[model samples]
Target: MILKRLILIAIVVLFSCSHTVKGQAPDAVKKTFQAKYPEENDPDWHKDDHGYYEANFKIDGIKYRADFNADGTWVETETSIDEDDLPDAIKKVIKEKFDDEKITEVEKVESATKGLFYDVEFKRKGKNKDVEFRADGTILN
Candidate 1:
């Protein structure tokens, strides 16, 4: 009986200490993003296969990807804006406003058809802001 009780206690402790595979808390991910890209904000963060965090955003109508380590440091980034996929107006506006800001993450929201846009995230002027722009480049609050 004592052996069984001890085994049960060990199992409970192990499970309690384990990190959930779903990912860490949202704030933790946000803090990590902010630390790595101080100029960007409101990134859509998700856990990738390697158990690291991945963020998506757009800058100047260009899609960008940023991968973070478990501790939230930047692992890698890719910047490639597909003009054919993005509306020309949005492309133009982004180019005009955020020439220096780097696009870090993007998400295609399906809630509204006509207003469909890439939720662009960027680092600019030592601050971070979430900019929602229509495919046609209309900024939405």
Candidate 2:
């Protein structure tokens, strides 16, 4: 009888602790992102199954997606450029340079890739041009 009672108490304690862990809110996740990526602005967060949060935001106009732990540290990030937001001139240049080239990736940067240019990665004529184009689609050095 005593063993059964002890087991029941243990089960109850474990259940309560699990509930507390699962009940953590989205704000906690937000706080975690803020603490880690201090310069990030206006992040969007939502809950997902398996008791965790996901966040989406832009850094330097480049979109990024991040997943956080229940306690709010980053798990991983997927970063990319929003091609639709690219300027028309740049798009035109991309189309003209490689007629058969299909853009695989685009990124906007200020310094790393030299100025605010689009680092477009594409394949054409069986060759790949990971070319950088200005906002106006002018190829950069």
Candidate 3:
């Protein structure tokens, strides 16, 4: 009897510790995510380090994730952007400066604090490098 009671207590503890952030998110968070991504549904939700919620979902064959607060406020969004989809100005800079480098991956980072920027990763002769650029094609770092 005592063993059964301990097992039941352990089950309760496991359930209580789980925040239940799975499958569907809260209504407020769903609304927030929907406002920006109208066509997306059933996002995989997880709690972020900053006490915000992150929703991971796919759109048009591209992977995207957006973060939000409990009150349905937008925190930030990161989308896997194709290298060819980069803005003309950014492409121009890469063509001129990194003629031989291969663009491995590009991300569109939109944040509330820092605003918008492109986080680009490129490869050259088995070496990888990362760069941050403003919308006007100025390299920030």
Q: TM-scores of the models, in the given order?
A: 0.37, 0.42, 0.62
Candidate topping lDDT: 3
Candidate 1, 22: how far from true, in Å? Answer: 9.7
Worst 10 residues of 2 by lDDT: 16-25
**Residue pairs of candidate 2 with colliding backbone atoms:** none
- Candidate-wise lDDT, in order: 0.65, 0.67, 0.84
Q: After best superposition, candidate 3 residue 86: deviation in angstroms?
A: 1.6
Where model 3 places Cα greater than 4 Å from the true spot, the runs are 1-20, 24-26, 49-51, 95-103, 122-130
lDDT for each residue of candidate 3 in 39-78, tens digit (9 for 90 to 100): 9877888876677788888987878878888888898899
Q: Relative to the unseen true structure, what is the C-alpha lDDT of residue 85 in candidate 1, on a scale of 0 to 100?
A: 54
1 or 2, which is superior by lDDT?
2
Candidate 2 vs. true structure, TM-score: 0.42
Q: Model 1, range 1-141, lDDT digits (tens) per residue? A: 999999999999877654343334366666766776676665666666676677776655666667667655556665544444567787798899877778765555433133345667776576767687777788886
